[model samples]
Target: MAETRPVWVIYDDGSTGHMEIPEGDGDPALAKPGRLVTEAEYTARLEEIRAARAARHEAEETARLEAARADYDALIAGGFPEATARRLSGYQGTQAPAA
Candidate 1:
């Protein structure tokens, strides 16, 4: 039977988790009092967190762009200067589209 012992884990975000310690690392009882995690576990957790953060950032950016587009559309419809409209729309301060 494979021997397993509890191990302490401190996550990158200052959190903690515990897992079975590998055999031959002295002993679980003798292990240091610090965070511990398997390579696979750590990688999976980090990737999951990164993916979530990326998704949130993308959503926020999309919302911001949409708001900017709406404001630009309103300005263009209201007869604002073409250069000003394009600038507000994040364009290169070029001429606006012909009405």
Candidate 2:
């Protein structure tokens, strides 16, 4: 049977999660009071966190782009110059459909 232990984490963003880990290195980012893991657990957790972060970043970027597009369209409707609107809104694409 594999060994496991209870670990509580207090994160910087005022968040927390439960882990079956042990106190090892004094790393703040790992686990509160810290925790150790088996090679298998480490690898699996590493992949999981990476995938989660990537998905979150992609979603954020998509939202940012959408907001920028909205801003660009609003500015153009308000009679702002294209260059000024693009500059302020962070939108570089042409507003009209291709010919």
The most accurate candidate by lDDT is 2
Leading candidate by TM-score: 2
> How well does model 2 score by local distance difference test?
0.68
Model 1 Cα lDDT, one tens digit per residue, 3-83: 877655555564446667567666344234555667676667667778888999999988887676677777788888867
Considering summed lDDT, which 10 consecutive residues are worst modelled in model 1? 27-36
Global lDDT of each candidate: 0.66, 0.68
Model 1 regions lying over 4 Å from their true place: 1-35, 89-99
Give the Cα error of residue 43 in candidate 2, in Å: 0.4
* 16: Cα error in model 1, Å: 7.1
